[model samples]
Structure formats: C-alpha cells, structure tokens
Target: MKYSKIFQYAYIVFAVLFIYDAISKYMSNGDIYYPSILLAALAIFIFFFRKRFSKKFDNRDNSK
Candidate 1:
C-alpha cells in the first residue's frame, strides 16, 4: 500500500479510538476536561500528518 493510504488508515483508527475513549470517559466520570484534552491531541496529530504529507508532495512536485 501507498504511504498516503497507510496514513489515512492510521488516522481513521486514531479517530475511532479517540471517540471511544472520550465517550467512555464521559460515561464513567461525567467530566469534559480529559475528553476535551484527548480530542485536542487527536486534532493536532491529524494536523501534523496533513502538513507533513502536503510538504512531502509539494516538494516532489516542485523538484520535477
């Protein structure tokens, strides 16, 4: 599989795990802080992956 597809699948798994964690936390403790923090972290992970891939592709295109 391509690296991009691998990244995409990883993102999906991370998202699913994050959602499940958030829901479990909410149900167990009724606190929003931890879940919010986890969500923010997941967002950062996605953003980083996006930027990294974009840069990689951009550089490749520019060099050609």
Candidate 2:
C-alpha cells in the first residue's frame, strides 16, 4: 500500500515533467515532440490507474 501511494504520486510527477518537456520542446522548436507526448500520455494513464487503486485502498481502510 505504501509503495502504491509512492508510485501514484510518482506518476503525477512524471506526467508534469513530461508535459513540461513537451511544451518546452514545442516552444523552442515550433514542432510537437511525439516522444514526450507519448510519455505524457502513459504517465497520465498510470496516474489515473493508481488513483483508482488508492481510492479503493482508502475505502477499504475506512471500512475496517
């Protein structure tokens, strides 16, 4: 559970970083960086996925 929370927050951090990277690349090069976009997408997916699990864990804890 602790590790899950860590990974959930990590995903959010990675998502932010990837999005920043994408924007910076676009600003500097006037072109969309596909790799950064893909990474951002994956990071968002993981963030949401872990969020769901975290919510479930919280619910379980509260019910105990």
Among the numbered candidates, top lDDT falls to 2
Scored by lDDT, model 2 comes in at 0.89
Indicate the worst ten consecutive residues by lDDT in candidate 2: 1-10
Which consecutive 10 residues in model 1 have the weakest lDDT in total?
A: 1-10
**Pairs clashing in candidate 1?**
none
Task: Tell me how far the alpha carbon of residue 51 in candidate 1 is from the true structure, in angstroms, after superposition.
Answer: 9.3
Put down candidate 1 lDDT per residue, 1-64, tens digits, no spaces: 2676567567656766777777777789997657655775776688678867777987998999
Model 2: pairs clashing at backbone N, Cα or C within 3 Å: none
